[model samples]
Each structure stands twice: as structure tokens, then as C-alpha cells.
Target: MPHSPMEVTRLTATDAARAARVLDEMRASTLGGGRAKLAPRPAIRESWGRMLHNGIDPDHDFRTDLLSRDEVERRRQTSRLRHTLPVLREGLLSLADTAQHIMLVADADGRVLWREGSASVLRKADGQGLGVGADWREETVGTNGIGTPLVSRRPVQVYSSEHFVRALHSWTCTGAPITDPRDGSLLGVVDVSGPLETLHPCTLALVDSVAKLAQARLRDLHLTSLEQLRAVAAPVLARMDGRAVAVDKNGWTAAVTGMPYTNRLALPKSLAPGRCWLPALGLCSVEPLPGGWLIHPTGDPEPPLTAPHILLDVSHPRRWTVTVSGQTGSWTHELTPRHAELLYLLALHRDGRSASTLADDMFGDPARTVTVRAEMSRVRRYLGAFLDHRPYRFTEGAEVEVLLPEAPLDLLPHSVAPGVVRARAAAGGQAWVERAQR
Candidate 1:
């Protein structure tokens, strides 16, 4: 039925006639209100054999082999949807520079999580196919991207009339499924809808980019949940993420910070910007830093690279802050909303809160423990980037706390500060977090 080169050769005249006769008779049976079994009924075949005064040719046939287009479409959908998180609505307002319609995120049972973009554009988009609370799966609404991708566990671009819904002929959608890497499960989907005429190859990529950004953010949540890290300061900063038992030269976690959580999580850029701690390398190594332990031929001899065992040595309980450099952003310039959020959080809780406690008191929607750990890490990373007296870098067995800025509201955006709240409950509790209400 699709327009592909994978068609079979045409049937010969005699065969075509026979096919016509079979189909005509089948149609007549239905029209005349008589049931005609297509199987070899002796009388039916005899009648057709006689009616076909012309001899039937064996050459006539129809082609059926296809190039497995389903796989092509399926893989595309899977890849696109794999990592994107649905962008949640924060306030009553929507973001600028997007379709004028609202997009919703839902679980398998069709419960809405988040939705926002352009309300006017969304209303028109709804007419094309999607609508508030409407399911978009192949089973429920047809072979469109969002619902079908969710069902199929992939990214999908349902185009033109491929949709099963007659009301969706004018629509096309590109959708990708969001996934949680810590446990490797489907979180939901992110989809973009627009007119078929405006479709371009970049369209899907944009949706894919958003998904990746969201996934990156999601992964950050996971990292923030890991409250402890093996901060071994050798030639290279080795951040070993084994059980506390495997820490130190003896490989025994004799001293542990009871803030219990997982060890292995993604490394956020804020924590290790220019440096990468390779777990496979066994030995750690530092890079060419600006100027610390410099050995200039003409200048005084610089201090030797700090020893790795310093982290475990009781004589030096505080490991020298390994200055992994090159994190440059809003600190030298203006602060972003996220910058404000991090600064606010750090400012509010000068005393380090446990990763779990931070999730409980600071955020409105609760991320999984893994996600929470990553966000905490992000919170720390962001503070390190902006604040003059950035608090603790990262270590296991203890909570990190930052001293709030003296000018409390300095982190808030001068323009939008009044409209924003200082903090909200985590795990999707605020009025804005509840999508169905919107």
C-alpha cells in the first residue's frame, strides 16, 4: 500500500481476468446479501471456470515482499525518544519560541505529568491530532509519533495519512521516548507537532536535542543522589565509586559518612569540566593547571604534586582542594534562571543538607534517589562556578554546605524576582507540578 519500489511485477492478462472474476464474484456475493466462502467451493470454481470464457494464465500475480520499512521507522523512533524528558510547565506562562500549543507528558496509563509551550499553537495542534489528555498510541489514537513511540518504546514520525485516526489526516509528529538510565526504564516521551508543510530533517533533530538535554538533566539527578564519592588525590584525582569498603589503600571503608546512597553515577560537567576521571586507568593523573606547583628554572621550587593517600591520612584529614579549572559561565557575567535557582538553594541552606534532605525540602517534584543525587551534585557544581566562596567540592561521608551570600536576594533575577517563589516541595507537589489541573 505504501509508495515503495518493493512491488511485485504486474500479472498477465489471463491472470488479471481471473483475479477480476474472483473479486467481482466476491463483491456480488456481499452486495446480493449471499455468503460466499472464498475457499475452493466446487460450484463457485466451476461457475468462474465457465464464466472466464477466456483461459486463465498462470503468469498473473501480485507482489507482497517489502523492505521492512517498519524496522526503519521503529529504530528511528526508539533512538529519538530514548533520553528526552518532557519539559514541565513552571508558572501559568509558557516559554517563548515554540509551537503555540501545550504538550503533555504522560505515563503508560495516560496520566499527564507536564505540558507547556504555546497555548494558542497547541489548540491548533490539537485539531491536527493531539489534544489535552488524548492518548497518541497506535492502539488508542493511531500510528502517530507520541503515543505509538511510547507503546513501541522508540522515536516515531507518523506522517500524512499513516495515522489510523481519520481526524488526524492533516497532522505529522516526531516523538521520542524518555528513559531513566539508573534503572534503565522508560520514563515517558517528548514530542513536537507542527504542520506537514513545515516539516524538515532538522525538525526531528531539534526534538532529539531537547530529549538529550533533558536526559542529561535527568542523569544529573542520578548523580546528585550519590552523596558519597571516593575523593582520592593522587597524581590524578581518582574519584573511585566503589562501595565504602573499597576506599583507601587498604581498600577498607573503615570511615564512612552515614549519608547512605549509591556510588556510581554520571559525572556532571560542572564537577569535572576539563578533567575526566577514567575508572579504567587504575592510576590518577592531573592536567596542565594554570599555576600552582610550578617549577620555573629561574623561580623558587614549587611544592610537589599532593600525595594520593592524603585523603586517607589522619595527619591531613582535609584533602587539598584539587583545583580542576576551566569552568567559566555566568559568574563573570549575568546569572540565568538556573543560576539563580542554584545560588538560591545554596544561599538558603548554608549548612549542607543530605542528598535526600535536599530533595525533600528544596524541590517540589521528587526525583528518584538517583536523580536527586545528581541534582545535588549539579547544585554544588553550579555554586562552584558562580559564588566567590563556593562551598565544598564533593566528597563521601559528609554533607556539603555553602554560606549564603550576604545580600540574600542577589541571586534572584532583578526583573522576575517578585513573581518567583524561594522554594517548593519536591516530587511534583506544587500547583504548577500538577499538569491535569492546568
Candidate 2:
């Protein structure tokens, strides 16, 4: 088997020639007969499989058409990744240049949108077709750090011959994926690369750390935007009477009046001025606000207390959907992994859960009520009528059912929320105990 990354790093450090020989053997076997006695590292081998299946030619110097200047500018204007560029450069560019490496940032689609660092490295990169607008997706260019990390959704290092393409064997690259904090959607990847001689085992860790810093900066920007919207909402909500709230375009609650404070309101994909049925607070009149929308509860009488059927499906790897059926009709809402965990927790404890209890469950910290309350507010937007607050709970008349994955371990695969983890552990243990009894 191919040595572990740590072992390879150590070998490269102490016996570079031997390590190189092993890599050469591995590559020769893979390309010539696909019967390499020594396999590459798991990640690299997996990436190679994907590239081969996609019909990528390892010997050919692949280059896809670059984006037009106008299109590139348009992407920069619209991409959230734009806000992270400064953070990435500040964290990486100087060090990368000094180390004879280049720092490159590619969008989710693997299009290199920004590149900088050592001039020599940049020129070498250009020759390798790694310039801005180049498609470096695994299928496009074979396994390299930028595209590989995006596909793996983690930090990855492609060292010398570990790269699937022959042309990339002279270089080493480390990259980490950056995802949106608001949602788990990938924004892009940030990578540091140089000639094979510059391979430093620490590069992957450094890139991963900087990627996290970029995400932190993005979170700060999101919070700042919310604060500004809150400022604009204050005066508007102050004049409102009876249940009204000012919410941003994404339904982040900026201000609320005549009701309990909520973090966000569920909003339709498109907001237009008029009366509409909102999941939370029943029917409401919506009006365009400066940075968001003004929602006013129409004071419609609460529907009869007929038990609504709620089905929480967490079977999918990436998505969770909640289906609600009752007097009006059935509506389904797709939830983020975090929201899925929260809803699952709420369903488990049908009686109710205080903000602090939920915070503790979701984050392992009772003080994280702000985040819990915010997410719950969003949940209410779609299930508001079926939910009740002040120690949030499904309305007493609602019947809740949850659909779990066939394999208990498969539940909420992307969720790191403490509640989901605990649920998984508990279910796994129960399964094991049942097997033991049998």
C-alpha cells in the first residue's frame, strides 16, 4: 500500500530520493498497467479513479477555455468568495511568495478566479495552464490540490507524482475548501503550490487554518450586514403595532414588535408586496423595506386545533426535508443540516425545549442560545402555525414523525450539531444492544 501522508512526509524529509523512486514506481504502474503493487494514498487513489472515470488523459496537458474578461468581472461582483480574497491574500500571499509558492483561489466550479504570489511560480503556473479562468476541476486537469480539496470537502495535499497528470508531477500543492458559514455550500478553495522540492508537510495545515480564518471573516461580514439591517429596521418596527417584524431579503429578522423576538422569518424565494400565507404567524401583509421586508400579521384567526402531521426526513446525505400536512394542505421545506438536527431534537422532545436547552443540545453550550434561537426562528417561518414558542415546541395538536437513514450512522452525515451526534450514538448503541440480545 502507498504510505500514509505522514510516512510519505517523513520519507521525503529523510530520504527524498527513495520517496521519489517509490512515487515514480507507483505512477508508472498506474499509468502503464493499472496494477501498481504499491497503491497511492487513499485520497489520491480515489481522485485518480474519479479522473479516469471522467476520461481525463494523464499524459495530455489539458487546458479548458478561459472565461471572458467580462464574465470574470461579473463573477467577482456576484460571488461571496470576493469578500474572502483580502483575508486569503493577507494570510497566504506574502508567505507563499517568500517560499517560492503561488496562492490561487478558485470558485466552487474550479475556475481559478484569483492567483498571486512568486512571479517565477506564477509564470510556471501559466505554462501549466493554472492561470485565472483556468478550469482546474479534477475531471478537467486530473487530481491536484485545488480541485481535489473541493471534491473531498477538506484539506488535501497532492505531492509530486501523487498528481494524476504527468505534467503536474514536478509540483506539489496543498488546498482547503472554504464554505459559506450561513449555509454549508462550498464557496471555493484556496491553494498554495510550488515545485516538488518546496513540499512542506505543514502546507496543508497552514492552508486549512487560513481557510478557516477566511470563513471567520465571512461570518463577521454577515453579522455586520445583519447589524446594519437591524439599524434600518429599528425605526420601522418602532412604529408598527400588533405583530410585525422587519426582515432582510433572506428573512433574517432585523427587528420585531408586538411579538417575541425571533432571529429570522421564513421568506418566500421571491418577495413581492401583497398579502401572502406565511408558515409562521399565518397570513401576513408584506411590503418592501430598505434592505429587507416589513411583515405584518393580518390578525387572522388561528386555524382549528386539528393535529397536523409532520414528517422529518433526514435520509439524504446532504439535504433534510420536513413535510407538514393538515387542514390547508401539505407543504414541504428543505432544511440545512443544522436546521435538520434542531428539528429532529424538537421532534424527539415533543413537549418543548427552552432556548438554553436547545443551545446545549445543538452546540454543547447553553450560552449559545443566540444561534439556537436564530435557527429556530427560521424553522418557525415555515412551520410557525404548527409550532409554538416560549420554550419552543410543536403545537400540542401536531403529530410528529421522523424518517431516519437505514444505517443509523448515516443520519445527518454532514451535521456536526451535538444533538445529532448524540442521537446517532444512542441509536447505534441501541442497535448493537439489540444484536447482542439476539
Candidate 3:
């Protein structure tokens, strides 16, 4: 009979060799369809299940082709993580080098964009095919620090034999995911990795704390940009006549006149200078500002007479969006992960869901109604009258459409919401499961 699972972090440095041996036995027993004397840690076990479901080979060290150098440069230039490089380097590089580990940052798509730290470990990582431009997604490469945290959306450490791939048993890695604070969009993950002997209990916390600092730096930069936009908006809005507001490209409000101050405006994906219909502001004349847009209410600020059409697209694993069309015009808004989950759940349960019900669907905890309500309020700002409360649902008269991924496993890959998990499970793991069995 197998003993209860052991958390790798609890092991002392002197127990490193023993811990690896035990984990090895646990992994072998689990993978070979036989029970052993030990069980894997919760995160490792869950990650291993995903790996098996996806048909990943535990013995074979599979890796996708490295991205071209030019493509790597292009991604680095465009990634939001580029802006926080200084913060990450300052916080992690020195410690990583001293500990003989390497610090690497992978984009939301799991492509490594930045790498630095101990010279010797860098060479070893190169041998492991973990250099810049490498793909580290869990499906591509068996569960490891970089890819696992991206899916789990939390800090994680894969120590020695805890790694899903058998060849990775000699290494250890700790990583934490970083997200955009403004809208809760995942940016990427920061990871510190080295030979198994260097594994330390504190590494996970250190990586997580530095990742938060990077997020704080990004937030500060956003605030500074908003301040600059506000400076330009104040003067222009002061001269406007009727109800108007100044908002950034992402719909963050900077100034308002003749109307209540809104924190955000929900701009369309392809907004331009002209007459446009906004959910919150209705028919309006839009003019380009320095770093944002100026809006003046034109016709009635009320919704159109006919019912609107809403299309919720969750086909892509990483990006989700909602498009709304009415008699006046059409607009699409990119959704944050949490908003995506709520909208998806509402779309699934067209009859409507109470705050507690939504909480249960999202978090598997009905007591989290306060959090559900807070998120729903933000969703309503852009959705406007199209979404109704007191049992949140789309308006009775509106048309709703949902676009799901072809493969069940691809549906919201980052989401572990109980509802989404159940939906995916209903598909019986689809193609990947078949591929793995073969």
C-alpha cells in the first residue's frame, strides 16, 4: 500500500537524495499502473494527470523546434514583459547567479524570451533544450516549473523527480506567473532553475515575490501613462459642451464632463476618430487625443430600440472576446480570463445565475458571492443593459452566441473552474487521450 503524498518543499536539504528516490518510486508506480509505497504531491499529481490526458511521453524528451532568431527578437520587442525586465533582473539575477541557477522568462505562449544567470547552468539548460525561444508549455514539454505555473496561475516548484518527464529527474525549477494588474491578463512566467542539488524550499517564495514586484512596476507604468493622458484630457473636456469623457486606448477614463465619472469606457477593438456607439456612452463623436480618445455624446444616450446580438468567442485557448452588435453599430471587447469564465458560464446557463450560483460555478465555493458580484459589476460596465442582474443573465430579448474550441481540452486551457472542468471532462479528454494511449 502507498503512503500519503509528501510535499517536496518540506524536505530538508540533507534529505534531497532521499526525497528524489521516493519521488522516483512514486512516479514510476503511478505511471506503470501499479501502486507504490508513496504518492505524488497534489500539484505534481494533477500535472501528471494532465500530461497523461494529453498523451505526453514520460520517457521521451520531446521538444518542438526552436523559434527563429528574428521571431524571438520580434516577440521580445512586443511583449509586455520587456518593460519589466529591469525589475525582474534586479530582483532575481544576483540571487540566481549566487545559487548557480538560471533565470528565464517565458511569454504567455510558453516561448522563452529572456535567459540569464550562472554560466555553467546555462550550458546545462542548453543541453536540456531550455534556451531562448524554446517552447515550455506543459503539452509541448512534460510538466515543469515554467509550464505548470502558467496553467495553474500560481507559483510552483518541480523538484528533481517531481518533473513529469523522466529525463528531467536530475533538475529542479521554481516559477511564478505574472499577470497584467489592470485587467488581470496573464503576461508570462518567471522561472529559476538549476541542478537538483541546488533545490531550496525558499526558491518558490522568492520567485513569486519578485514576480509580484514586476506586476507592481507594470501597474506603476500604467498609472503614469494614465496621468499623462489625464493632463491632456482635462483641458479638452473642459471646453466640451454636453456629456463627454476622455478615455485611454484601453477604455480607462481620464476625464469627464457633464456626466458621472466612469473608471473605464469599454472601447471597441478597432476604435477610430469618428461617430461611434459605445455601450456606456451610447451614440458619440470620438476624436483622437494624445494617448487616448475624447468622446462627446451625440444622439440619445439610451440603447437602441431593437434587441442587440452578442457573440462570445472562446475558441482560442489564451484569448477570449465578446462582440456586440445593434442597430447603431457593432463592437468587440477583449475579455480578461475571469470575465471570460463568467461570460462563458452565463452563456452555458442561459436561464441566468444568481451571484452565489456563479460563485459556485467559478470557484466551486458558493460562499464567494462577494467576489462574483464584484466581477459582474465590472462586466456590466461594458455589457451595459445587455446584461441583467438580480439573477445575472443576458437580457431576455437579446440574441446570444457562443463559439467553443473544436477540441474539448482546448476550451479555456488556463481555466480550472469547476464548470469548465466538468465541460471538458464531458468530452472524455478527446483526441489527446487517444494519442497518449497509442
Candidates in order have lDDT scores of 0.36, 0.78, 0.84
For candidate 3, what is the TM-score?
0.90
In candidate 2, what residue range of length 10 has the lowest lDDT sum? 429-438
Worst 10 residues of 3 by lDDT: 429-438
lDDT (C-alpha) at residue 5 in model 1: 12
TM-score rank order = 3, 2, 1
lDDT of 1 at 64: 18
Task: Write candidate 2's Cα lDDT for 277-296 as tens digits.
Answer: 66766778998877778899
Model 3 lDDT tens row, 313-395: 99986789999888777889999888998999999998999998889899999999999999998898889678888899998
Ranking of all candidate structures by their lDDT, best first: 3, 2, 1
Stretches of candidate 1 off by over 4 Å are 1-102, 125-130, 228-438
Error of 3 at 254 (Å): 1.7
Clashing pairs in 2: none
